[model samples]
Target chain A: MKNKVIGNTDIVSGILDEQNEFTSVYSKGQAWLNELRIAGKNAFSEQGVPKFKDEEWKYTHIAKALGEHYHLPHTYSLPANQDLSNYKLLDANTVTLVYINGIPVPELSDKLISEGVTAAPASDVENSSEFKTFLGSVADISNHNFSACNTAFLNNPCIINVKAGVQSPKTIQIIHLLGTDDNDSMCFPRTLIHTEKGAYVEVVESYYSLPNSNQNFCAAVTEIIEEENSHVDYYKYEDVSDSTILTTNTYFKLQRDSRSESFTFSLNGKLIRNDLDIKLTAENGHAELHGIYLPNGQQHFDNHTLVDHISPHCYSNELYKGVMGGSAHAVFNGKVYVRRDAQKTNAYQSNNNILLSDEAQIDTKPQLEIYADDVKCSHGATTGQLDDDALFYLRARGIGENEARNLLVTAFSGEALNEIPNETLRDVFADKIHRKLSVMSH
Target chain B: MLNIKDLRAGIEGKEILKGLNLSVGEGEVHAIMGPNGSGKSTLANVLAGRDDYEVLGGSVLFEGNDLIEMSPEDRARAGIFLAFQYPVEIPGVSNANFLKTAVNEIRKSQGLEPLDSKDFLILMKEKLALVEMDKQMTSRAVNEGFSGGEKKRNEIFQMAMLQPKLAVLDETDSGLDIDALKIVANGVNALRDGKRSFVVITHYQRLLDYIVPDFVHVLYNGQIVKSGTKELALELEEKGYDWIKNEVAV
Candidate 1:
């Protein structure tokens, strides 16, 4: 606290100082979301940016990042007709949702009208009954400053809805492109995904920053709710520029007999913090949380996941793997909580890390708190280097040193990649990982 | 041809291969038999350019090139191959991909073009019969979840695929049963040509039965204490290593 910036001003006052600017940009017609914004603002005032002293933020230090000055909403304009052909997925039939600076690009979006899926801007449904039930329901911003701040500046939000008993024919691709020319600009992109009973959909969220767009900050909040017997697959790929800082919080709520699988791929960023919370509220709910973070060149990645099993017969499994190189730092804290009434809960969590360079550091902790006696919970964490014997074996087979290391590193991420469930997407991720390795090898 | 002269190497400041000497001519299969801790594997590992083994003093010549100066992979590209006693399991890399990459790397170093996938598959099919390797194993991850005997056979299969000029088998017979040993030996014998050589390092003399060696050398305390014909293996088998130790003492 002694080395604080902004003249001892807390994060709330610093952010709320731009309230008039935010209101002019966001508060147009909707009184409900405006009321929610007031709540979020109040919450941020009560709880400022999380400090290292907080148990949840024990490993990730956000004070320094929050202390910096960032231009909030209404300060930047979207670039015209950006070329994204290179970022498009090849040979896949996908519904593309493009967002620039947290605002949906109507000209670039494609519709899935025949599939009974609605991909539209979140602001369109601000007054709808479904939006009232789904928005901000999964994610709680009461004690979270970043989430609260994101809520307070929510504009041009993305909403995806799947009707009951309808199965999406193609994957939904959401591209969050940051094309801000000015440095130190911040954007809060909100996404709400809701599925009715027996509906199935797969969504991919990709984050990218244009060249020379450094010092940009993005705070994203995504809430996904799966009704009874619904299936949801969510994949997040974070590959921003080195000068950007990204804080993302994704929430998942599963009802009875519903299934959900979420995969997060953190490949490149300056500093990234991801908080994933899953709540299984009804019986026989199942959820899987899997992620792979490959950080190099002074980049830092922190992932904190919480799986709360509040209903009986709920199951949750989490596995995260990371490879750090070039003085990179990574942290993984996975917590599983089975409540007292949640009997027959089965929760498993594992985190494995490989420090490619001696200077690279990794701090991983896997914790499980099961208040119910009938639960089966297990957690494990391991940090180590590449296997010497395996490396030598590959080398002796005429593979070069770098090639051998790349082979082993790629192999290390194979298990998590296999959890993607989709064949083409899995290959895309595998290729991305290989390309990242080649870049690092140089 | 391969040659080693007074090769002294150690690990962690403790000398293992002290004043060792060996020479293998082209077309010859030389069996280097030694008891446990006698530096048989050490000699094999040293020739493979394993960095963990510090060579205190040594000089090795492989096809007139200084073997000591080459990296492990360079040595491999220069037609040297070592079948590890404990084959490492590299998860997520298919056995076929590993062999293809290895063969292509060696071919590239030799200024030869790589084999196309079809040609490589045909070659793989032909070589799979040498060790009776299962076709399914080729598609699975390299050596992951392989049985001990199958792992050893996989080693020989890889040797066949790479077609190294000088192959060093480091206790390839350690974990194999009699039947598996015959399969591995048969595979090795089939690969023997007038232009290639092998340094078979084993603790048991029984492996020498199937892949009959042109020469047998008894290694004692890191040195080749005795050199003789194929009959020398039987002599060592019956008399045990103590006889050689006693003879050296005398």
Candidate 2:
């Protein structure tokens, strides 16, 4: 892989070199990628990441997905009749960018220069040191070939930058509408949102695909930076009609006294995996992550998240809840790391899942890597069906069996759903999950 | 009207109710007094269509319909209400919301229009007054954070809200204080009507003093071996159950 360094810092040149693999994190990441390459698994290449037939990939295997061998078409018939109004984020009056089949949709995009917020392609920001140095630098993509493959291919990455001292609140929504030409061509989209000192901004990235294509790969990476006294709200929504393979990676870093909150809603995807990383670099930094994933009809969803605390007096909290049925499977792997000097760190993580079917399965692991003896760090994971006692009580009161189950599930996932503070948005996301449950009920 | 003939039921392999028979017409109140493990709760559960109990042989008719064959929800829709002895606690589900769901479900089953939120709240407030239930209990999760007396009062409160045709009070007096018992008994008394009947199951004769059962049946072991008027409850309270168990060993 040939990489160029346009900035004086040469961060990408240094990061892309094989010599950086000496670092432990980079080493493991590289080793993982090496194994993936050996296993002949590249997202687009003929030798893809090893199939789920292997034990490590058994829970979620792309090999079993239909049309896994389709070649990426240079151009897809960009469907023009598709609508984008429903993809708007709450309070997204500032600026928005809608991309369909890698092309921007004009009518629904928010390119308001009057608001002093500028949006452009990755190349526009590539000239700035802040963009190139920090873009793909922190992510140890050495062996996450899927990530590496994405970085190697995604040429039209979007850039959203919020400069220092800006306030009053601004938001941008990135909508990706899958077209029939990309019909079978996997798309690797990337985004970088930089919130400088005292700047407050929000980015809502939503994925909406057509009903015909279940044979596409959506491997994306989104990076965020919150400087001192800044606040960043990042939201991601995936509702792909249960026939897509989507893997999203999020990397975020918080400066001293900064705040970062992320909310994710997964309504429909045949196979979905989300990798989230939040690192606190200074004291008094706060990070919060909330997610809701509802999978039905033999769909598979996986979420891998890590929160790293390097400075003392930082706090990070996470809550992920899922509703699965119809032989649906959900796997969650959450890891929290506390450095030796990161004392007084308050970190907690909980992953709860409900099995709506006897065949529905869930595997959750909450990993804690704590080096600080004086810190309060705890993690918990539970997978169970709705309470039978509650079910009977509801039924005994005349609530039909199906309605009773839905109510219990809504209650179970209500904790995660509460993170959506906006009432209308919360209801919309919850309703989407409810609709998915109704489909599975049949 | 309700009737049970040669009823035998139990959980798992152990028989709880054996050869129990009784009948009650509309507007009548019957009391079943028994020692623990003598199948008192089992009878109430069977009547309410709880699946834990297996009715080996029995015939139960409610309003001339086969009550034994109906599902628990169907039985509830058919106007049978049981005040659970140890009411289960379901956290994260508010009492008011639960009751609303129940009320609407029963309404749907009976072909009656569901109560609007305003009317439902008004009805709940009215029922709360009868049981003297505090608002905190209804605002919190079902049976969660409730005291023993509050739980019993909640049972009566639900009975008030549902307005069932036949209500079975299962150990409603077991954990209540003098005041809670009075409030519970008074709530039941207020709901009594010419069209609805009640079956009160308890171990003590105190509750019977409040409701004043028209017929008293002494259940020893699995069978209702003795029957009498209200005087029978007074005699059981005096002699205790050991004497009857020994006397009725045959």
Please name the candidate that would achieve the greatest TM-score relative to the true structure. 1
Model 2 C-alpha lDDT per residue in residues A1-442, reported as the tens digit of each score: 2121122223223323312232333334323223322221222232235355443344665545534243343454434665455666455354677766554556656654634344666434335444655667555464344566456444456777777877535567788765343445566677777878888777788987854654566677788877888888888999875657888878888999999889888888878888898999999999999898888887888887889999999999999998888888888888899999899999999999888788888888889999998998889998887788778777777777788777777778878888765566688777877777777742
lDDT of every predicted structure (CA atoms): 0.86, 0.76
Q: Model 2, range B157-213, lDDT digits (tens) per residue?
A: 998999999999998999688887898899999999877899999999999878888
Every prediction's TM-score for the first chain? 0.94, 0.83
Q: What lDDT tens digits, residue by residue, belong to model 1 across residues B203-249?
A: 99999999899999999888899999899999999999999999988
- Runs of candidate 1 with Cα error greater than 4 angstroms are A1-11, A73-81, A125-130
**Tens digit of per-residue lDDT, candidate 1, span A1-442:** 1212222255456567775478776688555578777777766666667777777776777766656566763534445565777566534678888887788877777765655687778655534545877888877888566788788877667888888999988788888887466767788888988889999999998898866685778889999999999999999999998888899999999999999999999989988999999999999999999999999988889999999999999999888999898888899999899999999999999898888888989989888888999988889999999899999999998999888888888989988888878888888889999998876622
Fraction of native Cα contacts reproduced by each candidate? 0.77, 0.59
Candidate 2, residue A318: CA error in Å?
A: 1.2
Query: For model 2, what is the alpha-carbon lDDT of residue B175?
Result: 69
* Alpha-carbon interface RMSD for all candidates, in angstroms: 0.8, 1.2
- Considering every candidate listed, which one attains the maximal lDDT? 1
Pairs of colliding residues, candidate 2: A33-A143, A40-A47, A41-A48, A41-A49, A42-A48, A76-A181, A180-A183
